[model samples]
Target chain A: MKIRKINPAGQREPPAERPIKRRATKIHYGMSEIVITIVLVILALVIIIPLVVPLLFSFKTQLEFAYHPWALPKAIRWTNFIEAWKAVRIDQGLLNTLVVCFGSIICTIPPAILAGYVFARYKSRVTEILFYAILIGYFVPVQMVLVPLYRMEVSLKMNDTLYGLFLPMAAFGIPFWTLIFRSFFKSIPREMAESASIDGAGHWRTFFSIMLPLARPATVLAIIQVFMGAWNDYLLSLILLSDQNKFTMQLRVASFLNSYGTDRMPRYAAAVIISALPTLILYLIGHRWIIKGMLSGAIKE
Target chain B: MNVFKRKAVLRTEPAKRKKKDPGRKVFVFLCVLPAILFLAVFLYYPIEETFRLSTMKTTGLSNEVFVGTDNYEKLFRDEEFLAGLRHVFSWAFWSIIIQLPLSFFIAFSLTYYSNKLTKPLQAIFYLPNVLPSAITAMLGKFVFAPNYGLIVSLGKALGWKWLASIDFLGNPDLAFWSVFAVATWAYSGFYVIYLMSRIEQIPKDLREAAELDGASMWCYARKIVLPELNYPLRILAILCTVGSLKLFDLPNMMTMGGPGNATVTLGITLYRHGFINWNYGKAAAIGVVIFVLSLVFTILQFSLGRKEDETI
Candidate 1:
């Protein structure tokens, strides 16, 4: 049976005694918080300025932005929305992005959970060797795999297909996601599994009926992380599928920039705002959860 | 009554004596089979292929020749490749020089002085981290739009012709820094969020204690907070290092490594030689080098992570 380490705050064997010399060092932390805060605010402005500037400009006319680049728009260029939409065909790109995201989520998450559970519970030399081998997969840069993968897809006649992109993306996301899931699963109390076993549940029954339900938080996190990754991806889509019709939103949006015309800037403006919307919405809903997950992982380590 | 107890005890013996089930073991293996198989095919196979192709030559006409070590030799001597290496280091230098400690400062500000006003301010700062890189790149393009661009308008009016006279994207000397600035703009928020998350993990007692002791803010930060954040700071450094080396998209979009390859990174080089130039052999060599570089750095990162884990 695995033993759980008592957390630092929970250790109560002895009264917390302070060393005299260390007390002086403790005095420095509060003043530091102020300094840290000031530094953070200034840095935030530096980052925010560039991001906010273009967004502010998106609402202005070309003439307005050129002449008063830093000023607020005279009035919102509401027309730019429809114009960017038509110019970039953002609706179609969003549709494609959605399809790719859901498709890969379906492909990626369940297997990761099942695999993570077994690795965490089964505990054997073979499993240990296999888990390390899976990690080696993350070492190969995405760029190196592009050509051979493209060749492999073409030969298999899966080129220019959504399935083509979906499978590879799912495959690539597995290694890192699996690592996260495995570590998380390992942290769950085995007593929970023991109780399920005592109830006469078999491995499969315990996994599907009890363990999967309990692992929902991590699973949701995995889904969102993979969704974000698949959404932002440009290189894989650019290389794998040649047909413009098959383009993911990222590729489509980027291509809009190169579209030859005097109206390119407005189109560019629309494409960027449109492409960022789903992510923004996702962030609004899932922001707190994602941040919580990251902090728990980072700090606990 | 004695016979009944004996019969019960006898029945329990068989249940206890039942052999370990090979069937159950196989079932467990099957459960993990899909993940293992996928990694082998998608990941393990391609890595092997890169190493294999590095030794072979692919002519445009479809001939493959075995030319061992010649590719690596050629790379060392290739002026263009050397220039690309220089660009990557310089890119990394400028980015880390500005962005790393800058993130620490932002994180400190957002956490320390954060009120209703600054809380929203922090969120606004992190907005870029959520947006897709493609959008960030496009936004950068909007701001850098030559004569009518934001920087240009501000510059010429202020009599800063050097900024106006030099084409930001077209000039070799300025191209790299311009790209660096935009990349910094896009990513500094991400690092801030990362580091800030770590800083928040620190306990509240330490903060209260420091405040009561009349410790100046700078001393508290330098002594207490920065030490605790040291691990994240290290990880961020390694991530930025690898990122700068393999930087593909920003330079591609902004300069196309233009003004004659002044801004080309190893990633750009591999893409150009392999995809655009169709010199598959040379591209494979570049890929191999990149693969090795990525592997080495990843190992370094994990080792550092492991060391921190041990200390804690």
Candidate 2:
């Protein structure tokens, strides 16, 4: 039995509460530090300007935008945002994207979690092959399946519907989450299930009451990752869903901007902003969870 | 011989089944059923269909005419597809060299520099990745747009008339690199956070312990941090390569694989063939090649990752 190192809040225990380690603290108010800070600040400003440039242009008039390299807008153009919102039909797109996110999570998460538990606990030749077989799906590029999926969806009369888009999105999500959850379930001690069984709890009873609750963090991580995947997806939604009314934020925004005939610069900027702002705000509020979920699943358990 | 083999399997299976509950098979079946349904119906079936499509002349207006391996022959002879493949390798190469090291350097600086600035600076750098790539590409376009763009306007202000006159995205070769530079800028922040967090995961006391042992900061980093980071760096490198292989949205939205196919990735090639040209057979052939290449990468990733696990 592997002992679980239950480290709470990621804090390591102090090394005998040591003293006289000024050298280890490593530099205070030095020239190198100042140089590093100046260099990094400049680098940060330059790198951040891509996202910031759109926001700046979204405010500027066409004439003003053409002339200014870097300037505060002479007058803020809320009209630009307004026009972008109408042009992209972002309100509808937002509604559809939320449906995709939740719809995908619902379609995939429960089944993946159940499948993950069995794969983690059971040992057999058949299960091992099944596990790797399902994992192979995760490796396929969406491009590989595009033509056939289109044909399949149309034949089933599932094309141009919200469920049609989300179902396939969930199909891809299931393999990935199954991998994450299996790793998580493996970290759990088998003794919990064994004891429950000893106390006459059936497999279903032990799983539902005990194992499921224990996997709350992993489940939330899977939810956030799946939600983000569905949120940021452009290709699948672009191809599979044709109705303008049902377009996801990415599809609508990309189609609006990528119209080859004209460059609607200010509106393009605004539409891009409208498309991205909510998620950036959400990311700000939830960075800890997002980072933890993203890295912790694939890299570490 | 088959009956004897069955008898051997049955004899071993019964011994292994002695402690198994009657409900075990049912429970396992319930757990596995949904995944099997999805993997089979959606993913695996579609893959097979892609292979089947590759052997035909599919237009959907007419019946798919079986062309055997002729489509594959045409694709191999196609210069555009080969160029796209070269572009993918180049993109992956640049990402691993330029982007990975940039992430590593900044992460090193941030961790060693000061305590107060790390959080805010990290947040600002990480802001790029939060938005969609469609937005990232569009934003990148305005910055590099000719005549009245960011680079040119700044150049004109600085009295560099040649820089202002240059059209970064209009030229074929330049367009590819400009998009590459933009991607590296947008994505480096993500890996910076990855590296920094990995650095942060090393216990505080361990650093102090190294210091107590008379090791300098550089010595500690080289000895402790670098070795610890080796595997994760390898994994991130593979991910970057895989991501480059799937390069679609950024190049697609930014350049539209334009100025005569300068920035066309395998993905863009596939998309154009299927949707734009209305030729699904050639597209599916490209898809099979991509699928094979990525499977190679995935298997490499798994084997490398598993090798580390064995050591642990």
Q: Can you list each candidate's DockQ?
A: 0.36, 0.49
- B185-253: candidate 1 lDDT, tens digit per residue: 777877777777778778988987876565666777898899988878878887887887788887776
For model 2, residues B50-101, the per-residue Cα lDDT tens digits are 9999999986745799999999899988988987899999999999999988
Candidate of highest DockQ: 2
- Model 2 chain B, poorest ten-residue lDDT window? B14-23
Q: Interface RMSD of candidate 2? A: 2.0
Interface RMSD against the true structure, candidate 1 = 2.9
Off by over 4 Å in 2: A1-29, A260-264, B1-20, B203-206, B209-219, B310-312
Clashing pairs in model 2, backbone N/Cα/C closer than 3 A: none
Candidate 1 chain B weakest ten by summed lDDT: B15-24
Error of 2 at B297 (Å): 1.1
In candidate 1, how many Å is residue B93 off? 3.3
Give the per-residue lDDT digits (tens) of candidate 2, residues A9-62: 666556544333443344542656787789899989987776677787788777
Candidate 1 runs further than 4 Å off: A1-46, A49-83, A260-267, A293-301, B1-20, B60-62, B156-163, B310-312
Error of 1 at B194 (Å): 1.9
